[model samples]
Target chain A: AQTVTQSQPEMSVQEAETVTLSCTYDTSESDYYLFWYKQPPSRQMILVIRQEAYKQQNATENRFSVNFQKAAKSFSLKISDSQLGDAAMYFCAYPNQGGKLIFGQGTELSVKP
Target chain B: SQTIHQWPATLVQPVGSPLSLECTVEGTSNPNLYWYRQAAGRGLQLLFYSVGIGQISSEVPQNLSASRPQDRQFILSSKKLLLSDSGFYLCAWSVRGRRNYGYTFGSGTRLTVV
Candidate 1:
């Protein structure tokens, strides 16, 4: 079984600053996928970024990027130029071969102006 | 482009009542469907998933069940609802393959069991 862990239960970042959310997972499988999802006040889950375990290079989507360390089984998400809209609950997820996602406890990010 | 839809943004049902949450996918075929439950301020819990029509797999044994009557439609049902079942229900769809992108989730339905 794969388990994702987000040590931080809540985080706060000043507007226009940068923030990094830590996530770690334990999985025996060699091949898998890691994802970061954002759920805003609307309660809609949106995909922030994705990283393939086979890819050594980290995944970047504009202001959202992932520091993926396959050897350490660590995938952390960094949000640059954080804005008020970035305030949401962020969840780190891992998908196995069966496409079932195991999610972390989630971190509530508060972007302060 | 693929999109997923879930109805009744919020549901309030009495205990022992039946539950039927529907999820449908558009602009895609043979995609993988999944159902997840999330307690207050918690992570998602995998309840069920379907790879194809009429095929369902249970992740955790509970009072709920799922069925895929159509290729694009997936339903989560329970004959008698429990208070523990009160949580946010999310429906997601993903392409069938390891190399495919991540899953696309619906708006999610908040079920409040009284």
Candidate 2:
């Protein structure tokens, strides 16, 4: 069974600053995908970014990026130029080959305007 | 350009009452559907997933059940609701062999069992 762990339960960042949320997972599969999802006050889960295990190059989307270290089983998300809308519950997820999406406990992100 | 829809943004039901939550997708076919639940201050829990019409896989054992009556439609139900069942229910869709495309999620349903 694969398990994603987000050590930080809550995090805060000043608007326009950067924040990084840590994530680690336990998986034996050589091929897999990692994802970061953000759930806002509206309660909608939105995909932030994704990294394929085979790709050593991190993935970047707008202000969101991921630092994926396959050997260390670590996948962290970095948000730059953070905005107030960035405040939310951020989750790290991994989907098994069977198509089951496993998630980390989640980190609540608070932004100071 | 696919979209997912999950309804009854909020629901309040008494204990032991029957429960039903519906999810539907548009602009896609033969997509994979999933049901997830999020308890307060917790991670998302995958409840059920369907690869095709009538083919549903449950990830957890509980009082709830799921059905896929149509290719893009999935339903979660319980004959008798339990207080533990109270949580935020989310529906999502992904391409058959390319979940890398990311899960397009619904707005979610907040279910409260009294």
Candidate 3:
């Protein structure tokens, strides 16, 4: 069974600062995809970023990036220059054999101004 | 552009009541549809998914059931709702073979079982 683990249940970041949410997973498949999703207070899930296991280069979106270590089975999300709107719940996900996503417990991020 | 719609945005039902949550996707055909549940303060859990019409897969064994009558219409139903079933329900869709693109989620439905 493929599983995603997010050790941090809650995280705090100051405005203009950077914070990294740690995520690790267990999977035997050599080729797969990883994703980070954000859910704000509105409860709308938003795709933040994604990383392909076959690609060695990390994936970066404007202010969000993922440190995907395929060998270590780690995929961490980094929010740079955090803003107040960045406060939300972050989930790390890995797809199973059937393409169904296995999500982590999630980390509640609080951005302080 | 593609869009997913799930309704009603909020629902309140008594225990043992019936449930019918509808989800529809537009601007795409033969997309993969999924139903997810999120308990309060928890991550989303995959309840069911469909690769094509009438081809539904259950990831978790529970009281809920899902049906795909049309290519873009997915429905979640339950004969008798349970208190444990009270939570947020989300509908999502993605390209059939494009798992790398991730999923596009709906605004989600808040169901409260009293």
lDDT per model vs. reference:
0.93, 0.93, 0.94
- Give the per-residue Cα lDDT of candidate 1 at B18: 100
Docking class of 3: high
Native contact fraction per model: 0.62, 0.64, 0.77
Where does candidate 1 chain B have its weakest 10-residue lDDT segment? Answer: B94-103
Chain A only: give the TM-score of model 1.
0.97
Worst 10 residues of 2 chain A by lDDT: A94-103
Report the Cα lDDT for residue A69, model 2.
89
Residues A1-113, model 2: lDDT tens digits: 68999999999999999999999999999988999999999989998899999988999999999889899999999999999999999999988888878899999999999
Clashes of 3: 0
lDDT of 2 at B21: 98
* Tens digits of lDDT, candidate 3, B66-113: 999999999999999999999999999988888887989999999999
In angstroms, the error of model 2 at A20 is 0.7
User: TM-score (0 to 1) of chain B, per candidate?
Assistant: 0.97, 0.98, 0.98
DockQ values, each candidate:
0.69, 0.77, 0.84
Tell me the spans in candidate 3 whose CA falls farther than 4 Å from its real position.
none
For each candidate, what TM-score against the reference? 0.96, 0.96, 0.97
